[model samples]
Target: MAMKMSLKLNSLQSIWYCVFVVVTHAYLIISAFYHYHRVRQMDWPDGTLPKPELGLYMLCVTAALLITVLFIPTQIFQVGNNANDRTKLGVEKGDQGPPKWKGGLKAKLVFVRRYTKHLGPVGATMHIVSAFCLLLPVMFLQAREIEHGLLPPQSIWRSEVSLVPVIEMDRAPSPPPLIDTDLMSTNQPDLKPHVKEPPYKVSMVTINYINYVTALVVYAILYGDVFWFCHKGFALLLSVQLMFNAIQYSLGFIGVSLLYKLHTYGWDKYGIPEPAVVSSAAGLVGLFLTNNITIFLSAVVMFLYGYTRMKESELRKRKNNVEDGKCSVVYKGNALRCQGYIPHMGALCVLVIFIICKSPLIVEYLRAFRHQGDPRLLACMLYDIFYIFFWAFLWVVFALKREWNFNFAYLDEVQSVKEESSQSAGSTGSLVNDNGMKNNIELSFVNRYNQDIHQRHNTDKVTEVKMSPKLHVANNMPVITQASEKYSPKRLRNGSATAEECQLLHQKQEHEPIQNGVLNTSMNGRPV
Candidate 1:
């Protein structure tokens, strides 16, 4: 019954996975058509579209199609492998009994799950590669915009020109003495001339629209993983990307607002058109603001979810350590892992908000690139390139440094156990006998045997003795002792003892018998 339920759940998940893939491909197809139409409508003043523009749009469509194609095998293989793992584990646990019925839909599902595991990392690699490839065209287009000044300058107010009505009045006849008909007709004031100012053109609106769309597609590609996988590193990178999009849109909105304000104050004087102001304001609120708010909210959500996952993993690790008996004195320091500092989720969220609000400065800086010389543009381009590389470097560093599943505390536990075992083994080597004295009987016999041989070899020489208040011996050998009072010994001629030394020695001498040519006992009746 459990096996059946497990299979049912797997089938349901696989069905949803299939639906997601289908919808993704469908969206890609729609996007391709949209871009194709956009390319077709794009016209050049010379009646011939630029080759680069046409090619870029076509490449976008091609890239979308390529992503869809690349996703299919990965989806299929990933689902199949997941199902296979579930099946194997379930069967091993005795949840899966003998097959009840064969050659049915269940059988087919089982077969598909088990047989498709060989494709392996190919699918996962393709999935990641496709995701990475999606960003290349966007980066290229942004670089081109920076190079060619395709994006509009932000200083729209500087272009305003005042419109003054020019009135030409025929010279009035002096005092109108005689009403000459032609002269009186000419004196009538010409109808006040109407002066109109051309509407302001904002160049950034279209580029902002394009960027919003591109960012949306990229977000969609990462959406499933961010929610389902909840990988912290991936979440962090996603947050960064969303933060960038939000900031870019917000700045675009600011530019639109500036244009609106200029039009409101100087409309009549500068002849600003109503349509330009209305469109700019509408796009700012409806398009740019909407996208920015959405991306910002999504970034916050991802960060919160990732932080929650981290906390849960930490708790689970501690629980496992308690179960394994590895949580001891050696593991006291295990609470702080991965660089010894816990990330403050609240602080991180605030920082993200700060970035979203203040990143517009970057946009303002880049806006100056067009009005300024190529040097400024080059600098901006370098900054943009370095910005992404910096993020990539951070991602790599986090990935390499992060300790995901393994517990470092367990390593300390193992080391402690080894140290204890070695200590126990060493203590066991020294045995104590029942007599309560250290059992050195065998060592004593060996020392005695060596001393007897040494005494036989040195029988001809008299043992040197020093007069002292206390005397002691070690390992059956005489040891010289320091005297309480300093005394100088006189040198004897012919290497013989002096009369004073001989008399002092005789006062302390004791007679001893020899047995088997070995010296008899000294102080404790042990052989000397």
Candidate 2:
């Protein structure tokens, strides 16, 4: 079997890469937080500054990205470069394997052992920290929404706002002479009504909250193995989570980008609230856009971990005679059915949902809101087009090529059962005793029968047996004649013995003289 090799970062490389990721993410996190604070501080008198909790939510996701990034290196370090190398080296070197250190003060306590059994103390800590980091933004949003009701819906289209400014000469006040410059010109009609809030604030918040809750639940299962305890099962869950998170954020990113353009155009064209409003809002929007890039990069790291875990799981299952699509495996004492196409099908479902939710947003943004030849129009069109295409193509291709039916072989447990049955049969059917002495099966059976006969008979009866010099096989059957108690010759045929015959022979024992037949006896006084 070919060993699957995984690319591993050396210690120095991991350190350097981690340092770079940390430093860059640190800067971005600070920038995002600053922009979030700016948005929170914005003076919107009517509470129309879009989502109030977006800043805090972004901070939560950013923190999770950081921890997940740092966790990448630690997890990578735990994995060996070559799958088989560690096990082979372990056996050859008589190594006791990696040391299991009591993770922390809390993990060392007896009460904590149950929770930490599967993950171990250190792993449980990491999961708890990461899960909380991911959950923080969700709880915050839910609480904030409950405290302050959801924002009101905004217009999908402008009802009375003029597309072009109109100058009314009849209504304009007569200006003073040009020489009296103090009151120079008459006031002009407004170009368009100021758009105080985004058109999709309510929808955006609703979708964002949904995605947040879904992501939190998904990550909980993916990390803590809440639903599926098997490594491969959780790995599949993680992959699905990452894919869904990426797609959800991709949809959000496109929407945010369009909003940025729409807001910038409105601000520039109509001068709605002046550049002061633009600065804070633009900073927040820009922070969201950039933060998505960080998320994508972080997801790539997690995706690698998930992929590695899956491949290792497949390898392990194969070692235990469990193959994908052909057999299931015993995981956590339960049969877990697995196939290569299941996750792909899950990804496909996610893609379909993404299309359903995001397609209209993209169409509306491009066709209705964006002007012809807008700089961002082409880029957004290309991005969403290829984004959907990439996932659709990848998952569809994978799902179609792999088998859908599960064999339900349960190979692991089946193999174990076969081994146990073989062991029992060998132990019971063996011709050797427990003390390593060899004994003939037939001789032992006959000796047991003779002992029963001797116990049943108390009279002293002389029994004589003649030993034949050489026994010849006649018609492939060995026949021995023994004398009965009435001197009647009884024939003993080989390979034709049964429990009933043995019982009958014991019940009516007749050891008479050997008249015309000879019996060959061994030193134990039993016929061989």
Candidate 3:
């Protein structure tokens, strides 16, 4: 038989997924600083300096850092509350809570040890990755300062010495040819300095200094949140962080365009060194591409989380009002109908924006590749190529297979299984009926609704009823009174249900209630 599958990611899978994101982001950070430093070193022929425009790049890493920071707390909460002793250290739900400020050093250390023992791998990985992220900017700043020189050039003008033969003096007859070497030295022409190239003011050093410092401060604050194990606090912080990330990634395309324009300017006007252009472009592409993917994944995770929570909340609400079964059905249908698909829609929008921002960069880089083939460009292209597969995997594995309170299945697989079963049954006539009864089935909304209405209105005092599919419905209405007493839950449990009765049971399980009095059901019959 074809088995039902759910694509929801468990904790382990989610952690690994986030690890992929974190690794990519870390590379992006390293690449950004490396190339930014390289670009800063180039003294353009036109005296113009290239701008790395690290404002967005800084935020990009900051977003990644904050997300990692948030993840630590989430993990802490999950672990502390976990009942699985094998997965947790000594920490449990009521293990005297986290260390307080008034606690002694030993107490604090003991408290830290409990959580850290369980979270060591995850925390250590984050710290290692984030340390590079935090320190690279400062290194870039220092390198930029030392490279462009401790002080701006005193004079913008550069003078060149040229030796020109004193033809007029040579033509003039000398009084006498001195036998001494001093006479020959006297003929040496005086050197004259001519101003050839002038330097233009480059403010990139100051601009980057400010940018990197601000980024460092912002990143440090987020980093501090890592040790703070308050989920509620992180939730609030994440809202702001997410908003900032959204704005940055949304305008990331503009940053790319600007960087491209700067590179074009240098290449066209001054014939800037090719390596400089390539490095700058590579960094720009990698930064934005990776950053966009990171943010997109983050958005997907957030939406999926919210979607799961909404489902749980609804289920809780339904269970709490079990006595009002009809209200529960109506409430669930209306609520889900209105809001169930928001997460999918939101994720799709993020994906679309990600594509829009990254597509132009890919095309631009392709053109760059034609000009000069570099490993950096190849790396970017690889990211783009793999990103396509990643999107497919996410959609197919996470979105489509999700339990949306609607039947979603691999139709071909189901059909193949059904055909195989039928062929086997045909070869064994004695077991054919039993095989058919065991086959999975589904009920249509119309038939299910008829059955529900019939149950409510009929005077039958039966605790439960099961009937053969052939006798259950006629003319779109439930023929409940006609059902025989041969089928029951006990009989089905004992493996004695006939094919018709088993099919009816399967149909009953798949039945989804229609929204009554809220939505018009007149097309089916009349609103309940």
Candidate 4:
């Protein structure tokens, strides 16, 4: 049956555009967490706990300053005063709005509570961003038609427009297996050659504009009296993308070592069957060789090598921990789930196999729907759909992380549960007595349960110890805990401090572990 579908911008492709976003926005997310964990471990002039919420605030503030004020056009063209108006109602005392936003307008003005604890609305904001990204392109197109007198621009206010992609996807059957098919001519008719689809940059531009708008909207929400998330989530994403690009570009130029390259090539070329690397071409690739055994072989070698390297790195880290009794350095986690990671990689792998095997299924789909059935024949298009979903999913994850980075309403008083009962053998004193002075050194190190990075422990729980020497009175005595496992900082609340203190504390958090601290910091950085 013949079928026709119009191609449009801003549908599935919008998903693709958001992929790179995974790299940048995730950075800020990790940064928020870093600050959270950092603040938890630190100690200030008073015997108060550090609030991760400050890092969250810094991030939200940054997002607001950069995106809302800078990237977006100042004049908001959208209709209405804003659908998310919750502050008009007179807020009474005792009711912590949404259990996250900790203060009223007056308290917020005076740097009332430790970081803005209202994290609930951020999820809604993320949903809005995703929906906006999907729908804006369609609106822009309608806007275009209005400009050309084909459609009215005011139609947006009405129900005349919808945000669905125009492309029609016809699911096609899988191609006959290469081994099962006959090499010689059979009863089946020869198929027509396939051509590249026409470019859709117009829609792309529209998508770009919408993305800019959505980003700006998110930026503006960072400091709202109620709930907002942007800061570290956005920052981490940017940083991750930058680092990945740098590494990829570097790898592209140097072309992995010569011996390494030769060893992989040798096995792939002639079933030498030696321990080899993974196909160097396995990850994100540049040039590809399809319908050929050579590239496929290369992939196997590259895979082996990659696997070996990963194993070696893990072993090295293990050895260090065993000998030095010091924990290994842990890199930040990626914002997106790994499901996207392997699937995207799979698409590339499948691409290589198709090149070598020249799967007949691809040929039939092209013949059946080159005009209307191309979606069926094109595995790449399917890959395109998956990639889009991956990006959007990552955006949601990044938004959640952004919230985690900032919400500090609960930091007022964080009590440690240890009570000097469960201290390890190598544990130091809970209370240090000095000459004539009473030192009430409390082991505020709270109990931490987390997964073990090493393969030694199969279970996903570990205890954490907090030893802040900064609050120690005696110069000779120091707060120390056995370095058996990595320390997970315990956060108390989000707070504020002087800019000088912030920078110094921020630096210390990055390098040395936190000692002690507290301040009621606002999302809009202040001395509280």
Candidate 5:
């Protein structure tokens, strides 16, 4: 029997998804142009992977674009266009689509399978090459940065890793994806039933163990703060610090994984291995630059973040019962505040620097290989390349995405406010409070409406800023004054209070809500 498939998304959700696809596509288009232009500009022999590995990187990126595009069904909401709506598949009204079914993990798995079928071997090989190309420099020039004691370059050292022999001190195969021989998979249903699992699985499958080891390693290698502990008596400061580090590392790992998966599983017809590496080189560059660049980015983000809260605090100054459209302080005078996405731009700028400067670790690794006289050997000797542009592009994409999200969030709020205002405008007399003064005339009727909203969002933003008791805020720290406790604590801007305000607002240490005086940390998705 011939089967028909249909997919549908909720109205708003459909728009968001479409926006995501469009933005992603736009990034790809820009990157592609950059790659093509740079390629032509360089006038290198056609099709050779760019040194520092840009060619393969671009190819891999192109493949990723294809993979992402495939999953986005153009017919976002298909109900047979009304005529086909009355299909024989038994789909009901308002059912969201054919068979009126939800595409949960099962659908995702199907998409993944289809994706793999199209991109399996080619993309996989490209990824292998990408990893291979990236490690050479680490093995060569960058080896000094890592500590791998008394072993063969740290690749062959058998600990959690098994394959690539560490040429240095037990350093888990120089670059990584070290195999845990015990856990290697024997299944390769996509390739062959009996074929041993790809070496990548050694890294992918055992990553959890790697994380566990990382934690233990931190415990062994890192020292808890002593001076602060001596003075402030912070009981779990070390634990908190460890948790934050873990979270940061995990996020970085996730970003790399996303890039990796996009290159490997999420590629299109993965062909000649060399070009694929060139494509991913860009992503690698972005990841590398983040170490330095993100410090700047994060700093700016934190500041703008705080500033946004300041704007909110300013807006929320005095005036109880902020009616739909009324003059007060911040929004009272001006409906919207354009702080701009300074942090996102900073992140992009730094990532651009990474892209501009990225080079394959090959030069360094090649030196080591040459010095060690194993020029022909790379235990998993599948050479990959790295580049600056493609890598930086990943960060650029993220930065743009951040902007897009911010834009959408603001738009959503605006639309909702307009709806509410239009409704309220009809019911109540001119929202201009009795001074016969059009208090809200300064704002576009819509802006005023949007700024003033329902829902007790105020309380959600009234979160306490936590600092280890060991860290002290001097009396000179910034201060925030509270007006009244009557209003629900909506997040004013980024919802951060000044240092002094946060200190004053700190939950009393004596009134511990949770065990260990965890205070009212809402990060765990629960109130203490």
Candidate 6:
């Protein structure tokens, strides 16, 4: 059999990957539910809730349920079966044989495998549609907030006095009425009225829901697969989204900071007094930070996917010599030399940074307990706490414990098969051709049969050829001999060939001579 590189997922790694996927999906679903409940309980001042946000959250819940139903169980069952098969075989036997499934399990496996082929198309469509649905609504909401004075307007002069006409009053010839009492009142018109239109209501529920759904769909379509273009597409989408969010929030953060500074130090100079500026700054910062965390995590995930794909490609290109049917070089004694630890560590660092970024929200949540505050702030704090711990546990189990690594099959691991004519002359000793030429013939074969060993190798059949006691040649026919043995390639233990074995094979190859003026030869003991 021609050798080709292939992914060699072990039972443990497969199980860990399954667990990670299931837990991550569960977290997303719970988050969606929390968002839905939070948004539903919110009441706008005009008594109209954000219906678009509610619908998007509901769609996210539906998508989560569909993913759980369609993907999670199949992955669990597959991993479970794999673990069971490995356990039954024991470490000594190893994973050389094809997995055997019986009864209902086999049927279930077949059904899931067949149905998941369509998930790619379905998932891709869902991801693109959901992104637009969530983004457009959020954009509209932001514009609406600015228009209604719930959020800070673009410019105080334009928003407050753009329509007012400037008038100059000549000094009154007559003495001012009410004398000094009216002079005490300054010319500061009440700016509070202009700034107090309505409370800002920015619901992240819809955006969060959409992001969760998109992530889930993309993962379902790409997880545990080795399609290069699919991985690249996923990475590109994540990068684009991350850059967009980063730019948007950075601008928002900078603008809010400038407004807060202006309100603090130069408000009187600008002749503007809006008490809500502090709250506006806090709200905008919190909102932007929350979104930044979400987008950063998504980017981290996509980066990991791309990194894994690159590792796979590198493994395929690796060239190593084979000694006794095993690759001479084994990476850290692991069959699967996958790349995982670096990405896992990177994820942990990102999670820690996320926790740090949410500190302001945590403080706000604490203050909210003492005074009136946005419930969304409290909700975000709680979610951040949960998010941090959930990922911490995931890192401990999958990354820290190093369960993410797997074995890959390299080309050198493949065993070559020798094919020779099975037909035999009467005997193997002396043969006489019809032209009266005499030739000496010899055949030697070894037979080693072990059923457990045979099953372990998963070879279809093992043939052993032996030398006949006598030989007779006629009609100028040549006597051909083929060697076979019960040794199966699958069960061939991974190790370097001993000095004696290497020397014997080298000497045999070097000293062997062609016969009958025919240049018959074998490369690596396989007839050419």
TM-scores, in order shown? 0.29, 0.33, 0.31, 0.20, 0.25, 0.32
Best lDDT among the predictions, by candidate number: 3
Q: Tell me the lDDT of model 3 at 191.
A: 49
- The C-alpha stretches of model 3 lying farther than 4 A from their native spots are 1-129, 135-139, 142-306, 309-339, 367-372, 396-528
lDDT of 1 by residue, 1-528 (tens): 123432223334433544564465466456656755664554424544445644765665567567657655444433444222222211121111223346877776665554343122233333333432332233333323322334333233321121233444444434533657575465544455444553443333333233334434444334323322324345446546554544443334444333333333333433423323233323323543443454444444444334333444444543442222211111122233343233333334434543553344345334433433323333434444454455445444543554443222332343343334333221001011222222221111113344322221122222224322212122232212222222332111111122333234323333534422323344343544
Best by TM-score: 2
lDDT of 3: 0.39
lDDT of 5: 0.32
Clash statistics: count for each candidate = 0, 0, 0, 59, 48, 5
Overall local distance difference test of candidate 4: 0.29
Q: Rank by TM-score, highest first.
A: 2, 6, 3, 1, 5, 4
Model 2 poorest ten-residue lDDT run: 425-434
**Candidate 3 — number of clashing residue pairs?**
0
Residue 227 Cα positional deviation in candidate 1, in Å, after optimal superposition:
9.8
lDDT values for all models: 0.36, 0.37, 0.39, 0.29, 0.32, 0.37
Please estimate how well model 1 matches the true structure, expressed as its whole-model Cα lDDT: 0.36
| Residue 28's lDDT in candidate 6 | 55
lDDT tens digits by residue: candidate 5, 414-470: 334333433322211111121222122221112222343211111122233331111
Q: Model 1, which residues run further than 4 Å from truth? A: 1-11, 20-38, 41-43, 47-50, 79-342, 345-528
Model 6 worst lDDT run, 10 consecutive residues: 450-459
Candidate 3 global TM-score:
0.31
Flag the better candidate by lDDT, 1 or 5. 1
| Alpha-carbon runs more than 4 Å astray in model 4 | 1-528
| Model 3 CA lDDT for position 392 | 47
